[model samples]
Target: MILKTIFLGLEAGGKSIVIMNGDDAERLGVLSLGRVAIRFNGEEKTAIVHKSSKLADPGTIGVCKRVWSDLGLSEGAEVVVEAASFPDSLYFIRNKLAGRKLGSDEMREIVEDTVAEKLSDVELSAFVTALHSFGLDLDEATYLSLAMIETGRTMKLDGGPIVDKHSIGGVPGDKTTLLVVPLVAAAGLLIPKSSSRAITSPAGTADRAEVLMPVTLDLDEMRGVVERTGGAVVWGGAVHLAPADDIFVKVEYPLSIDPLLLPSIMSKKRAVGADLLVVDIPTGRGAKVKTIGEADLLAKDFMEIGSRLGITVRCAVTYGEEPIGSAIGPALEAREALEALMNMGTAPDLVDKATAIAGMILEMAGRSDGKVLAEELLRSGRAVEKMREIIAAQGGDPDITPDDIVVGEERLTIESGRPGHVLWINNSSVAEVAKAAGCPKDRGAGILLHKKIGEVVGEGEPLFTIVAERTSNLRRAQERLEKARILAVGDRMEMLIHEVKERPVVKRSFNLDR
Candidate 1:
């Protein structure tokens, strides 16, 4: 049947959708959540159908933003509407739902439909949930990676060794990439780094880097920056590298599962033509991987996938018991990272972790004195210079300094009640407190630690300070802090952690940062 287009001027989060009148829908034999084939001007596209009796007239169809843009529909253009069949990928998804492993062709079709926006949110959620329920093997992971790479934009720079780094993030205040990018770039290597924004953590690498410079550079701009300065820190979502991973991320976030962790990380690396890669797994009781053994297992999987993708991969299992540095928000962490790069302050752990990872990349690329060289570059101010170059190339202020980065003005200092050595720090609690203070959004809102693990604290001395852009947010963070044991200062470790009185609803914390 032919119908007139009634523009809805709405976006369904990149999904193609159209609203049909209830009578027209009945004649077409399509349900409210069914599919429709919209054809106009010899061009056709599939859209999800939403039946409405009042919203749309009987002889007209309401076109959403995605479908409207795709078909170039005008206010009263004529279009052909017909009942559409479900995609074949749905069958494959059902097979996976039944706990059967999918083949390469099946995985490819599902991922293609995902990229093409042919699958609705419900279907996509079912696919991700099935993967989470019945974990995918390495073969399935490789297929997913290849399909994701094929569907998205890729960067191909003519270079000898294209190196990159990624952190399986869980720990808060990890500004390591801020140092690693400049440090590695200073050593003269092409590093087109694409990072993600915060999903679960207080801040992601892109969130922190955005404080220092613009991270939404397109592929051309990213390549230009890397070509000129040997490195760049851009947001992955902007580059469209492994865009299917972005759609999958949306499904995984609500479900609190990340079964595609391997493909999600490796596919982007492969898309960027990376020759060498380093994956950082922060391992500890408070981290995503709660133990060293688990970290190693994750590392093995990464290496195996890397090998299959023709990229040399190494894993760095670092200490994750606490926040990486004293800062736990975007602006504050950026300031801390800048200070470490300039050697103006003592963030030994941050410096150590950055240099160690940079060193690994260097050593993997055939440098024996990797750590030493990394340290030298940082100590000699070369890393800072290189960082400035990168900032200038990426359209940020090259003269940006630690003092120039503004943090939240409103501050609350948490004091130590008794004198002792700091025993432990809860990474999750730190993230929670930081988030309460209007974290990534506020940019300046965060926490600054006065002491770390094993540091001696005097009675009534300040333990940490929480900063916020607004008074209300500061109060909110204060409330969360009251219920959280963020830091423990004691002469000896406590044997009993917590007593369970009865059965409790366990809210499993899943770290979804990539």
Candidate 2:
């Protein structure tokens, strides 16, 4: 039946949902809560059906953003929705859940179905849970990666040895891509750094980069930007590479489990045509890998997967005991990244970590002294210049300065309770506080570190500052801080260390040696 599309500004997370008037549902023989095959612009998708009396007239169908987008229907545009059936691949997902080892063909079929959104959130979650329960072997992981790559778009740089970096992620405020990309680009390497939005943290590399420039670019635009400036920092999601990754990610967000890590990571890198890749594995307390042993095992898996795909992969097991830097929001992180690139940021840890990661990538690309080269590029202003060129190429102001970036107007400074040395900064607490302040989404909201572990703090000295776009958000962050032990201080905290110290140990305890 043809029905007018009415917008419903709600996130129908993991499923397309359409709302209809009770009279329409009763008259059209459509029941509320039943599946409907919605069609518009020669495209069709199954969305969960909802019925409302006051929401719409009898002839109209209410669509949330996902449905309207998936069907390509304009507001008030006519749509045809009918009863739909389950997809053929749904049985394969069930088989996986039954402890069956799926072959490459089966995996590819499932991935194809996933990318096409044939699987419901329930089906998708079932697949993720099956993998999470039974787990995927290296061979299976490789197949999944290949399948993910095949299911979406692929890009190839004009030349050889295009490099890329990825973090296992659990640490917050990780904006190294901003520094690493520019530094590597200055070294004349093609580093098309495609990052994600804030999956969990206050800010992701792409989110931070977006604060300076646009991150969403098509292949041609991204290639043009990279060709002009040795590198480009953009959102991988925007290019729609390995689309299954995001589908799983959306389900995993609520499930709180990371299934199919190998395929999910490798597929994105492979889709981007990364020949030389660096995987940053932050292993410590409150991190994805709680032990160095686990990190090593995961690192081995990454390298082996890379070998299967014919890519050179190096895994850098960095410290993830805390957030990467002092700034844990988009605009704030972008500002801090620039400051560090210019060698003017007080957050030495942020600068040092970026240099370390970039150096490793450089070393993998045949440079013996990667750190030295990275530092030189950063210090000599070449890295920043390349970054500015990239920013300009992506339609941002290349001449924009760090100070020109404005963070949230509302601010709150958290101070030490007593005179002591800094002991630790809880990664989870820091992330929570920043989230409370409205980071990633609220680009201007975040937390800034004034002191890190082992730093001396006088009574009432500021520990960190939180900035929020609105007073309510600032207050919300303050309320969250009251329960979180973000910055620990003790008369004897941890021993005082040099300002150049690069400790990645998180605030919590871990079993790394074992």
Against the reference, the lDDT scores of all candidates come to: 0.93, 0.84
Give the clashing pairs for model 1.
Answer: none
lDDT of 2 by residue, 198-254 (tens): 877787778889889988998788988888888998888888888888888877777
**Residue 428 miss distance in model 1 (angstroms):** 1.1
Candidate 1 lDDT over residue span 275-362, tens digit each: 9999999999888898999999999999999999999999999999888889999999999999999998668999999999999999
Q: How accurate is candidate 2 locally (lDDT)?
A: 0.84
Best by lDDT: 1
Quote the lDDT for 229 in model 1.
Answer: 94
